[model samples]
Target chain A: MTSALETADNPQDMKRIVIEPLTRVEGHGKVTLLQGSNRSIQQARLHITEFRGFEKFIQGRPYWELPVLVQRLCGICPVSHHLAAAKATDMIVGASELTPTAEKIRRLMHFGQTLQSHALHFFHLCSPDLLFGFDDDIRHRNIVGIIEDSPEIARQGVLLRKYGQEVIRITSGKRIHGTGAIPGGINKSLTQKEIRYLQGDIGQMIAWSQGALELLKKVFFEHYNYHLGFGSIESNMMSMIRADGAFELYHGGLRARDRNGESIFDHNDYRNYDQYIRESVKDWSYMKFPFISALGQENGWYRVGPLARVNNCDFFSTPLAEEARKEFIAIGDGKPVQSTLGYHWARLIELLHCAEAIAELLGDRDLVGKELRNMGNLQSSGTGVIEAPRGTLFHHYEIDELGIVTKASLIVSTTNNNQAMNESIRKVANQYLDGHRLTEALLNQVEVAIRAYDPCLSCATHAIGKMPMELNLCDDDGELIDRLEKRADGRISRTI
Target chain B: MSTDKTFRMDGKAIPFEAGETVMDAALRAGEYIPHLCHNPNFPPHGSCRVCVVDVNGKHMCSCTLEAAEHMEVDNSSDAIIDKRRTLLQMLFVEGNHTCPACEKSGDCQLQAVAYHTRMLSPHFTHFFPKRSIDPSHPDMMFYYNRCILCGLCVRVSRDVDKKSVFAISGRGIDSRLVFNSPSGKLGDSDFSATDEAAKVCPVGAILPKHVGYETPIGQRLYDNKPISVVGDTIAKNHSEKPVVIGGPHE
Candidate 1:
């Protein structure tokens, strides 16, 4: 990777800014800003530090272990890896359709995953910034502060996550690295007791999800301009949708839309994702920049995740989330939402959808059926795609006749959003810090832009950590002028 | 009347039948001892010394030592755990046991034991050894990279299956499990999917043909519980149980 500092030219006239080990995110990252004369931002880049060579190392292993093995990529979103790998293995096994019981169980587990992940990002990470001011005391802008100030709201968030985790344990047999979904089908069906256990908490979960949406909506309306314009950029959107153009998470064909909300491609087979999307390797970061092939790299960069899914889909399958989606779209005035902070609103809507979907799936009798697996003959290749909590994820694999994985490729959700994330960071840096004296609060503005996407650097770079961030400002001659650091314990300090 | 001879293990008095090894006695009494190569169905072959326990003042392989009356054993002591952790680190370095990529991860006895010993990191440097995979069998695969040279397959194939299909040929650092057939492939031998040797592997080295992940991960044998609750010997006994996927029983 190119050093973030190297992006600037004319060292005599330019100042170099660097943010090492970006904080409040899942894994390690750094940001670099090259400032021209008069404080004009020349270049900005986000760098991913860790590299997990899961694709290369899985070469000699059996195809069936992909679901279990690939999940080790990210502790925060292992289920996304697990399900995507299972879907790909389903193709390797030559199963065109999973048994009803197996499909429902997998869906339940996925919904549970999405619920817990969104809850964690919103409550534990981002809410502190939204609830308190972004420029508030760094130590007070955390989940602990939320618990101290709003204990009831904090309790609901915790319970909501606990409920999602419980659902995962029931379906997959463990909370984090459960091996429930396999090729063709699941290993065991959910028992009646498990169903009853989740059903008892469904009412409370749904209420809490709605309450979260209300809280975000109220905050957005109160700070309409800032919420709508801060870190905002116009880009394309990509997501998965059912045949009816309804919102789909676990399984569906993919769709891409332009900034005006016109369909670029609707209900396209995800197996052909290579023809539409291309990953560009960069020297400075472990993450690959993915763009739409038709539009080329510059114009092809698009956003994914909750905002993209909500904007691209026709309607949500679940009732409560569908209403929230309508209200969210109305705020866009019949156009695609370009607000970056709007991602938080879109996330809550999806969380509501997940809770309702879980309740709906639990009522189905097939979840407990005996036809859990369809043992089919192995094929040479297979691909699986799903809308993970962050966005669309793809897992592709090729196996030999003996079922050993010969080749593998994965496009995780964070990778899909990589280009857009970098763009957002640059946009924020230019808007907030251009020709202005750098401060700890100004640096946080850059971080707020990145955190809006809730990008899992662990998934993108295939590593793990809480990640402490440091920002350094250098004068035109490249001499250090000032420094700001955010530690993992949520403390911010500055040195000059 | 023959009374069972009892031995103290980790402060608990564990009773053993005549001629029972320390590992067998502990397993039968629902006490777990960390081991890799030893299985209840096969005779103890002290090839992998993962089950080394401190007996009185000296260290001995629990699978090879017979349980004697009133014999005090230190299985969970800090020194023994530290020694086992070092041994595990060596095994990890010696083999390409990439648990993240292996199919037999959650069910692998080596991984569960590592968890039990609180091996947070592979303390030693990784050798990153270059090993070849044998996928010649129609229904099974042999990933040599994950092999710890446990020799369970060699024992099970020879004594129970009577196929004489697997063998170990090398010694010291060059030690490795080898196929006995002329072609050096599992397909060339008379090994069936149902053979006793097929289910005897303690790692991902000898995985069955089509059944890669019959059990999902979290529900797998060791996902929810620690390995200390179920030893390697009992995990082998419950390997055939349909409901229990990877780790030992509750």
Candidate 2:
């Protein structure tokens, strides 16, 4: 597939600008902008600068540890990794079906994970870009600034995230790095006290989730045309759906639809994912671009995550989210919403769906049932798939006779949407480039498009404490004009 | 027999047999003393320092110190809890005891004693010393990272199992658990899953693989109740199933 940088080099006429360690997203990434004479946008490429060798490092570890071990990859979506690995290893333990209590509790945990992850992205991360204009003051364009300026908005976001975290804490053991989901089934089910604790604030969570969706709709419609056209791309979409095509997150078969919303493939088993979906490597990025096999690599490269999930599902099981999904699909006018910014819209809908699902699950008595796990003849290989808050997440593992993880392959949500994210940023760069030199605001727009995907560079370097960051603004002749450094102590100083 | 030799602990008189240590005597008298390395089944080893009791106004390891008749020994005093917390803190930082990720977590004696002594954090800066994990064993995994150097497994394998499969090599921060095999892997060692050493780790160091987190965190040993109440030896019974113990020294 042709990339933005490949579209033009024009070495002599090109003036390059780089946005290093793109801010607010999960991990470190950079956007390289190539500008030609007369400020024509030459190219834009999203490069994942961090090395990801989690799959390689995890081999030979016991299979039981995979659910707890692999989750250290991303602090933001640890539960997604935890659950997906548990699901895959479930088959290895020979449990094709979990007990009712275990399945319900697992679903509750997944929904909670979706609720919190989506809220963090929509409210804390991307909301700054959407609520404040892309050109907002650099210092004030963040969740902290929102807390100071829009305290109510910030409070709701914090509370929403907290509610989801509480659900996770109660269902699983802790909020993060939980050991609730074990092979074959869950380790434990919810108790009466845990059930009551979760139910107490669940009503407020549902209301806040609905309000968040409404808030997104209002912001989206205020600049309807700009939001619709900004960073727009026509691409195929993919996700998992229930047997009857209802929007599903926990378990289902794969579905792929084209830009026109035509089903390219539906209900394809995730166990044979490699048979239908192929990942192609690019020399430019460490992440691979996954595409449909039938369409071939060129046209097969598609988008996943919330936008694809929203577009691919026929309807949502919950009434409120079903109404929201209808409003979302109506914007497409018969096709999938092609606007890159629509990701935020789709993400909020999922957040609402999870909230509603959490409320419904709270009333079920099975959540407090005794049966937690079942075991059968162990299998050698198994695959697990779940619609993570970001997108489709796949965890496949091959175990030895003694249940050691011989091999592991993961298609993280960020990796699945890698090509599409690059395309989105490229579109944003060109649209905002115009006939002027690159500004910090323009650089932010490119980052905003990438933020919509909420990519998690799994093996990101900044897992520990603060690191020094330097922002360099260069002149037309490639001379450094200004330098701003954020020191390890978080003190920002201009060195120019 | 009714007037058996005894030592006054707190306000109660703890009876003891001849050659019985304070820990053994107290446990035999239905008195609880928080300990990590000292088990009833194993001969007394004073390495953990968690069972420190104030005898005649001096801190001493109760497990190694012999019980004497009418001896005034204070257990669970304010000073003792403070020292145990500090000792636990050192043990916590000396090695990686990530209870959140550890399979032994709630069941581990170190964590349970930390909870009992209110050792909320590893007070000192973490040594984060280079440690290793040997996953070569099919049914067992040896995580030297979580090893507290208590010598329970070492003593159990040597004294009980009669195999001496595990031994603590080196000293101080450089100390590490080494297998008896030439390859230094448990899979090659004479250590069987049924060995007493397999169930003797007081921390998450010597774990039986493929059975982790099977008994969820909250329901595991020392979850609803403190280890003082439930006792560490009950791990073999409190687990989800038999033959794969989930608690302390397992």
Candidate 3:
């Protein structure tokens, strides 16, 4: 838009610059930078503008519908919501323990989701900045740019997305909003034909995943210092871990590791999460800042997602991922990886883990077994937590006697990383922004930091092309000094 | 003449009995007319207007219009298809027919008919008219949101079950399926889950309470094939055997 990083000298002494509706992320958001007379950023905030009252709206719906209906929150990761809600409803329906077939099929679906989502975030959203310099041509700097510069990467990404979707389609029914998982168990099993279909491309997917991880490692090492220091922040890490403290995405006890890689709490049941975690809201942002309750607001803010999961877990279950994790975690030197860009590397490792997990589940005969569902004693209330691609997702529901959800509290993955994303953006702004100028490249760097968390800001409120990028530079008197508008088609307009 | 005894629907000859509606004649010929209110086992009542076909370039409800000899019916014209799609869109927006989680999702006549007509999206802004669920019935559950006011339950209950247990109240946009019971709940009425009326609902409005999703989603009657091929699978959902979870459930 502005030659990627063309200087926007504020000779007129603009007080603050605001960037609205970020490009290339799942949804739109705004960032405001307040600069002082010195060549430094005084204040920076990544404001979440949209309010998705999903928890409130979900109340009064039939609890069974929660799995299918709540997935509408985000187009990218609907399966997480589907399975999370199904898990909660499983308790309500008294299906305390799912049949082996049902649980395995669900696990297979989660792996597919993780693979596709991580692939999309890397190749489509973050690759241009990583592969091509962030300061390169403004126009050719997205998925289109990737296609022109590296078509193989683009094809790999698209096919990976399709392969993952096919896994979902077979397991859930439709790729996006499949009605596969129900209260007690899944609706159906993977037929032999379906299993064969998935097994066909999984090897390719795994190889591609390894290749991509290697590529990312090479890219990181080439710009090793800059990549490590860019937007880096030290924070607590959190995720769901297996009882044995291995990496677990589907179901596990709660775990949070401090910056020193020591446990804040481990192996605790997540049902009492409210006692450990608390959310506080700021007036400037629509998102709530969740912190570990005992640590209090100032020190309790923690990050969740791939980087957090990899850091907090003891080891990876799959051999390839375990090897990769060891190599990757060696970078931290027995400490949690606090570098923001390290998120990309962590995500690729998980993608490889998913591919391997999918291959293992394909051979399991339980997937095709007939014992699909089992019911236990009924319960009125239940909670479900799972490791979504973005982070840890929580869904809790209390249904009335008539099986209607009377209360619901949903904490989506992106929401869990809200504070971490804000912290990352603040670090980027401090490092890149000069009080005298605000450039497109500098602004993009801010987004690059937030992209690490892969926040789905549109999870609750989604608007497509309607949300074009707009920036307003306002003075101390709250009067506009200069306005820069970037339309959906990449057209930029500036008026003073 | 043969033309005097038979009519052509999209150029297929359909012989009709006296007093038979166009929908009945086509259905008897084993052809699907993509309807919501018309069932072969019951009398045709064309209040939903989803089966409006072109006859001599005039739009008419096939479920209500009497079949005439030598009549030319256009059920597959672009104009007819567009009109059906528009009517379906209206029906979709007019009521809260959430197909994804509706117990009648894959099996629902409205959803199947929409699919058969290729109604990709509900084009109009939804009138998410708030409606309450009638879960008082021990054996049956009624989700009014999934109902399109198809009148199948009402008519079947009246004509087949002889209970006259259901009726539609209000006008136009305000119309909703109402129970005959004074408390306005299905539990207060004498409508049993085994009644033909319960089996005749084309949507999720009438369902066996505890036995929902007894048939998994993919292997469902309408899952593998379109409703046009499989036809009415909901008819076979009625159970003569007792349900283990039967009895009034809170």
Candidate 4:
């Protein structure tokens, strides 16, 4: 008697599952898993579908316009690009000698972005799977789901996002591109009364943020088995660490470390990044993977975004942020948890820290009366580096005597973690798909692992639509094997 | 009564609603106000702000301020005139308007308004912006430095004749009027021998680029030949005693 699971000897008995247009992620990608008859994994790949080209478009524009120009790159993290461009130009033009008040206002804007972006990433993007089980109706598993089960958290998300948007509005002079934030300085400063209002809101937000953190810790503890059972691939981590060796979400020296916390490159000299990072684009996708210099894909795997950030920084400046980091490190071997699930926890901790930092900056009296922007002579070249919600971002430019940009280049954060994301999906695919018919939950789990990277495919692709991703399985003779078709309803319509 | 306009002055009723300008309405209602660009013989030119008034929420040149219903208006107020003084100062500093060295110094409407408003000095910093001169035109010279962004040139070029050989470019503070063709030099534009865009320039910005220092300000046609002496007549009196200053439209 032959069992359905016992056909491992037959090569034709393998099953293939394909998940295309993976939803609830920043951009677009696909996950394809191959398994043998006994449900042992054969192969897996996270196929990305975007490319980066904003650097080429920046040439010939006036240097002062870059902050506004780069802001349109991503709606989710425009302020990051704006600040990065302004700082880069400031470095070139010697505008970094800003007053304490100006610096405080800038930090306030940065913290605001951190809070709102993290909330969106957590409640809106990833909560669906954790709250309801994977494959628990994707249509109903969004922020709306949180609103249904926890209306207060949903409202908090809205309020937090509004606070961030308001900071951008007040500081930069507009919420989006805010063409007013120039190289010399900003256009307008925040008033004392406005700071008091922000302080009041911050006081209210603290309780809500604490509750949210508690909820996240509860989720982490409750799902220990699933998280442990999830994919774990040892990879290098990269993020910005502050001057005093603390976690910094905005500006700092980037430290690229191995899985064991051994720093390979610890410097802020971004122009020399090409020597350490190598980017290559695949024909199937627009996203570029930057492997470690002189290393191939298998040996060169690095992760980024929140989990990588927490694993990297020794501690955070604020006491609350530090306590959260301690709680985060205590999970799974005390440091460098190999599972992608920890990204959510790291993000939540950063969110809490951002709120505290914003309140502190708002209370700084210098912020209310200082000059918003400084007037300066245009510089010939500059580079700005800042950490967006996803990871590190770089903007570099060379300008002519008239301040027209002659050259431009950008190193976005998503590119840094491409290899790790691919490997992450493979690890889970190997563990879950080993010789069995693909279950929707396992397939979803594979997608969720890739989502942990929070790859910005829209910025990567420089386009607005999904790419054509094909997934297929065949025997040695190229004859057809088991198959899964991507359906309009976003499920695997299949035959074995 | 049929040719009259109807509106309010400081919330008091008035008449003269048949498309007559707010300045004309105020003048008809015996409201004395200073003006530089409004010539009774010619159509109202709204470039100069000596007749500026605050209506509704915005400040407008009264010569061009269309009387709308229930429009809260403020004229001759210190705040309104202060802003107008700034605008006039911008015009004075932006151009090569050397009042003492100019041909139409004392009798020039621009100089008279400056004297009336008691403009002691250019309040804002001078831009000392660039300009061009065309001395090659047969009967006139065009000085572009003193050209204000009044739409008078655009209107004269399009409305009086069916031709529009001039248009403004680079909006906001960088705005500049350009000739219709690529040659760009005013002498080489498609402007005919009788294009009024040249004459509508209120300041010396568009004076004939040639024939310099010909008529002194007191002897120039605008100064010696006052409108009452020339009669309150239409602007096309080409046969009147010629000042040989230049053709109004070159």
| Best candidate, TM-score | 3
Q: Write the per-residue lDDT of candidate 1 for residues A48-90, one digit (tens) a residue.
A: 6657788998887778888888888878778888899999999
Q: What tens digits encode model 3's per-residue C-alpha lDDT throughout B1-250?
A: 1234678999899988877789878876878888887766556678878789999889999988999997999988878889989999998887787666576777777888888888999999988888878888877888877787888788767766778899999997878888999898889999898887877778787887655454656777778899877876543443343222211110
Q: For residue A436, give model 2's deviation from the true position in Å.
A: 3.1
Second chain only: TM-score per model? 0.89, 0.90, 0.89, 0.70
Model 2: per-residue lDDT, tens digit, A169-213? 887788888788998888888879988888899889889989989
Give the distance in Å from residue B165's predicted Cα in candidate 1 to where it truly belongs: 2.3
**Backbone clashes in model 2, listed as residue pairs:** A305-A391, B201-B249
Error of 4 at A317 (Å): 0.8
Docking class for model 1 is: medium
Residue B112, model 1, lDDT: 92
* lDDT (tens digit, per residue) of candidate 3 on A1-496: 0011112255345367788766433345788777656756666777766666778887877777788888888778889998898888888888878999999999999898888888887877777778887776667767778888899998998899889998888888888888878888987898899999899999999999998899899999999999999989889999999999899999989999888988899987887888898999887677788899989887898999999999988999999999999999999987888899999999999999999999999999999998888887768998889999999999999988877788998888777888887777777877887664555566567767887787364211112112366777777667887787766665556766
lDDT per residue for candidate 2 within B1-250, as digits (tens), equals: 3446889999898888887789988887878888888777656678888899999988999988888986898897898889989998998888877776788878888888888898878889998886667878878888878888788788767766778898889876677888899888888999999887788677888788777688776777788898888888534432443333233333
The number of the candidate with the highest lDDT is 1
Q: TM-score for chain A of every candidate model?
A: 0.95, 0.93, 0.94, 0.86
In candidate 2, residue B204 scores what lDDT?
Answer: 81
Counting clashing residue pairs in each candidate, in order, gives 11, 2, 1, 32
